[model samples]
Target: MDKLLSNIKIEVPPGIYLKDPESSSLGKKIVENSIILLENIGFEDFNFKKLGQLIGSNESSIYRYFESKHKLLIYLTSWYWSWIEYQLVLETYSINDTKDKLIKAIEIVSRTTKQDSKYSHINEVLLNQIVINENSKSYLTKDVDIENKDGSFMPYKRVVQRISEIISAYNTSYKYPLTLASSVIESALHQQFVKIHFKSITNCNDEITPTEFFIDLTLKTLTDGK
Candidate 1:
């Protein structure tokens, strides 16, 4: 179990980068600054030359780590999901109650992540902002099919699968465990996106995060027929 493992390593698909960003100090710096820049200017306005200036590295150096801006975005978002997966396990590991596990899973996925101080190399908090605002851009492209086949989305799918298993513990016969899991995860993102950008339409209370609402709705769907 990932929860029980120590010093866990997350694998970004080999296709996502020309070189592993964690391997060298410079490569790691590129990743650390990439998050800050992507969250600051947004991906549409982000480029290697700009990143090169930010990190005092040449554009060619950035290219050596990532083939294109698109791949970099994918790498960042994939890393975000992997981080989320770890948190999900850490948060829910002690809960034996199925409903409690389900609720915690939803919150961990939906709520903004706190920056993990031990991981100074990556800013979990800022990365969550990028995931909220720009994650779709990583996959909504012409190469999505190619990337998808190459396991670009496996980290994300693994997260969803973990939560889906928690749901199954409550209702093993539930035909739509994965479906329900995917819906809950996406709903968290969309609700927060809408609440932030188009608040007039969302009636959510400011005191309560979307995670609470999602958990209530998910519980209704899972327990309504019982």
Candidate 2:
């Protein structure tokens, strides 16, 4: 699986960046350091100048890749989702049982992320943190409709659609597979956020995980507690 993944390139929408960050060493450095800096200083305080200082490059050089921090966030989130979609397809594609495939798919999207050696330039763990905390900012904008039309959110939508197909295969009569699939993905992020920031409000912790909760929720909802 690692060998197969190493050969895969996670592509984001070309419209999101002024230049493709995966095309050059300097571009890759911009992406690698930007993840670390964004997680450290957060989206609100993160700027190209700070990233430039961290990478020992000029601010204008950073701008050559991303036009603005908002677009950069979209790129990061898009890349992360594309990576997750790859994991989903690779891990679940061979499972012959419909229910088993759905369970595996849920676990892949809901489980806490760990760094994969295939993409050393990306820290999946930190990228997961940014997704959990700042994912909404990428789309909750007046321009989201415009961006969606331009395929800015295709990676994320594709993930939901894949899982939704699994749900339908598991239960042909299920009327809201897409809704359930999207809810599980979005809620997984929210559950992780509350688990870390508002622990008193969520049951997920060291013993119980968001993965377990979503697995239970999805199965029960689909099967009506069968």
Candidate 3:
């Protein structure tokens, strides 16, 4: 353990404080700091000068690491999706019961969204843009494939597909409707977060946790087909 720790060096940005100096993890550290700044200030207000100052690094050095702010945003967005995919796969899909599978998938997704603040914020922004962009592109292009190439496979759709697959796995013999399951799953996933954070959906005064509501509502509706 001591040898491994000794070998593991982390790069300290030019002016950043480091209790223990290491260089190996410097890139990752910068990315993490970048995410914090992005979340607090957002992409519109974020500036490389400010970020470099905060990290104790020169603007030029930061640029060397990340070509541009837009590039960083894209990388961060992709990273969030990769983490989400890992989490989705970890949920046990073959639980031998259709309802349980649906509940588990919902639980994982809600837990992931609630726990990861940066990811949750990114997901909200990207999902809204993705929906609008894809819809607009589809109208513009006569070809569905061309429309997809413009803006397709948003995270929302990925989550819905994973949830649908889990539900379908358990009901393989019965062959539940994929479209119906997808609709309920998407609604259940988005409604919980959207209602509380985006806007109060109608007159519901309850501040329910996303995971509990999603798991309960999704499982019940998907299994019973009601």
Candidate 4:
């Protein structure tokens, strides 16, 4: 899988950036340090100037890649989902049974992220943390409608659609596959957030994981009427 992924490029919408960050060393440095800095300071406190200082580049150089911090966040989130989508496809493609495929897909998306050595510059674990803690800010904007039209969120939507198709295949009679698919993905992130900050409100803890919860819920919901 690592070998195959080494040859693959995680595509983010070109519209989100003024330049491709993966094309050059400085660009990669910008992305690499931006992730570390964003995880350290968060989006609200994160800015191009701070990232410039961390990367030893001018603030204008950062803008040469991303137009704004919001766009950078979108780029990071998009890359994260694209990475997950690749794993979802590669891991679940060989399963013959529909239910088994759906379950595997759920696990791939809902499971906690670990670092992948393939992309040495970008840290998948920190990127996952950003996705869990700061993902909504990427699209929850007045410009979201315009951005959606521009395909800025395509990677995320593709993951949901892929899982939704598997759900429909597992249970043809299921009336809300899309809703359920999106819920599973979104709820997994939310559950992780609550587990860390509001433990009293969530069932997920050391003993139980969000992956286990979603898989159980999905199987029950899809099988209940059948």
Cand. 3 Cα-lDDT: 0.51
Candidate 3 residue-wise lDDT, 1-226, digit = tens: 4454344222222222222212335555566566667666666687779887777877876666666665455445434444555556655634767666666666665553434343322344443322222222222335435523544235435656676677666565435546745655445446554555667462222556656765665556555643
Name the best candidate (by lDDT): 2
What candidate 2 gets wrong by more than 4 Å, as runs, is none
Per-model TM values vs. the true structure: 0.94, 0.98, 0.57, 0.98
Clashes in predicted model 2? 0
- Pairs of colliding residues, candidate 3: 9-22, 9-23, 9-24, 10-22, 10-23, 10-24, 11-22, 11-23, 15-56
Model 1: CA > 4 A from native: 1-6
Clashing residue pairs in candidate 2 (N, C-alpha, C atoms within 3 angstroms): none
lDDT (Cα, tens digit) per residue for candidate 1, span 1-226: 5344636776677779999998999989999999999999999899999999999989999999999998999999999888889888888989999988988898898886788765678998889888889888998889899899999999999999999999999777778989999888877888878888988877665887898888888888888745
Q: For all candidates, what are the clash counts?
A: 0, 0, 9, 0
- Full candidate order by lDDT, most accurate first: 2, 4, 1, 3
Q: What does candidate 4's lDDT look like per residue over 22-91, in tens digits?
A: 9999999999999999999889999999998898889998899999999999999999999999999889
- lDDT per residue for candidate 2 within 115-206, as digits (tens), equals 89888899999999999999999999999999999999999999999999999999999999999999999999999999999999999999
Worst 10 residues of 2 by lDDT: 1-10
Pairs clashing in candidate 1?
none
Q: Once model 1 is optimally superposed onto the true structure by TM-score, how far is the C-alpha of residue 168 displaced, in angstroms?
A: 1.1
lDDT of 4 at 50: 93
Instruction: Give the runs in model 4 whose Cα sits over 4 Å from its true position.
Output: none
